[model samples]
Target: MTKFLKTSLGLVAATSLLFSCNEFKVTQETDGSKFQIHEKGDGKTTAKEGDIVTFDLVIKAPNDTVFTDTYKRKEPIVMPVQKGAFKGSFDNALTHLSAGDSATVYVSADSLFMRVQQPLPPGVTKGSDMKFIVKIKSIQTMAEFQKAQEEKKNNEAKVMENYAQKNFPNATKTQYGMYRVVLKEGSGATITAGKSVKVDYTGKLINGTTFDSSVGREPIEFSVGQGAVIPGWEQALMMMKKGEKSIFFIPSNLAYGEQGSGPIPPFSPLIFEMEVIDVK
Candidate 1:
């Protein structure tokens, strides 16, 4: 299952039905899960196994409580359609959708928890149903998805390159695509893998929006090469000596990639002003 779907599962609880069963034609899956098409799409392309699907989702709990709503987030869930993870899984429900189609899927709460190997949340019981309201946004083949991703990456790279040229004219481009400018040199051994270091930093996007900082707070400590931070930070810190201050222009691939972290948009380039305070 995709991240959004997993989040929905964790939030699942017993919920009242939004519609009567007689109102819509329900089709049952091989594993006894069911779905009803609320609106048919005009597109002729139907999703199939191995294709990538983008869809908005809404999971509702009892008393009209929304467990999750992709529409509010403004990003739809995208995943490759595959064989159902279990009988009556969303994988089967997805096969019945086409671009622009809207449907409601009913899945067993108990089966969902069992498949994920997690205990049910409060208010959910052994045989309760979970409701998924989905709107199929698009479907693309694997090749198509890869091509689109490549295009996005290339576009972001160009934007970052321009930003670096204008802002840090003398920045050195690392082999992995990060741009670095040494603001202050320190005399001591440079940081290396397995070394623990404490650093104060302010992180921002390419457009100069500060997302995080450690100026007033105590410096964060982490071990080099321990995967404690983003790849960009790991690489940048390794090149610095204790007390050195540097500015780094990190590309999305080294920062958050396509799945951006909180307050960072996907494919965003990041800027960091960092000072290594201690090394051990």
Candidate 2:
């Protein structure tokens, strides 16, 4: 189910048994859990709670319908292990795996959908098995993963700084840390909190890829300072006057932060070219 894509519990993998690449093996434990290992690792490595693991996972239902696949999403699932957060046999199978290991853990479709509070689809029944093919890529302590994450954020910030300096030489940073460049000044009323305003705008990422726009459609109207938009738009719009045109370089903290919205990846900086069409 698509709900699995947005859940923290779905990131966990359960541990089970061992098998060889040359032969297919299926084992059903006394507890009614089943698993099949396609390829075994060297067995020198293992993971536990609080450790971070990176892996590619694909969930398949009957008829070869894929529920979700991290490989096709272009982003492998990297997450901290939190046991008992989810109610399923899948994660129990992960404890037996190490880096370079791959396996298919099976769970009853009824158990999974019931845990997520969803009804099973037509092709799946109560006792039907939902298969998860998981390939463990890497494992690290939480401290190591945190350090890597911080380094990644710093690198992205540096890239944004270089781009802003090279392309917007005259841009001024605001007191709240937003970089701004006014293109056209207006003599109309100043925009303020609680004021209703209408604007046409184009939004892009740091790479100049446009993600959204109001230019070809109707201008959007919203009340200022009402949390009606992203923090970037709310802050930048307050600095503009009616009919003013400006370009803003918003950091991730003021845009989407680490948990990005649709089409926007985590820790992404954004660009916006906007015109304040009216203030009411």
lDDT for every model? Answer: 0.85, 0.80
**Superposition-based RMSD of candidate 2 using all C-alpha atoms, in angstroms:** 11.9
Candidate 1 Cα RMSD (Å) = 11.9
- Residue 147 accuracy (lDDT) in model 1: 88
Q: For candidate 2, list the clashing residue pairs, or say none.
A: 13-91, 14-90, 14-91, 14-92, 14-93, 14-94, 15-92, 15-93, 15-94, 16-93
Error of 2 at 192 (Å): 2.0
TM-scores for the candidates: 0.62, 0.65
- C-alpha positional error of residue 152 in candidate 1 after TM-score superposition, expressed in Å: 4.4
Stretches > 4 Å off in candidate 2:
1-45, 54-58, 69-78, 84-88, 96-105, 133-138, 152-157, 166-170, 181-187, 199-220, 241-246, 256-268, 273-278
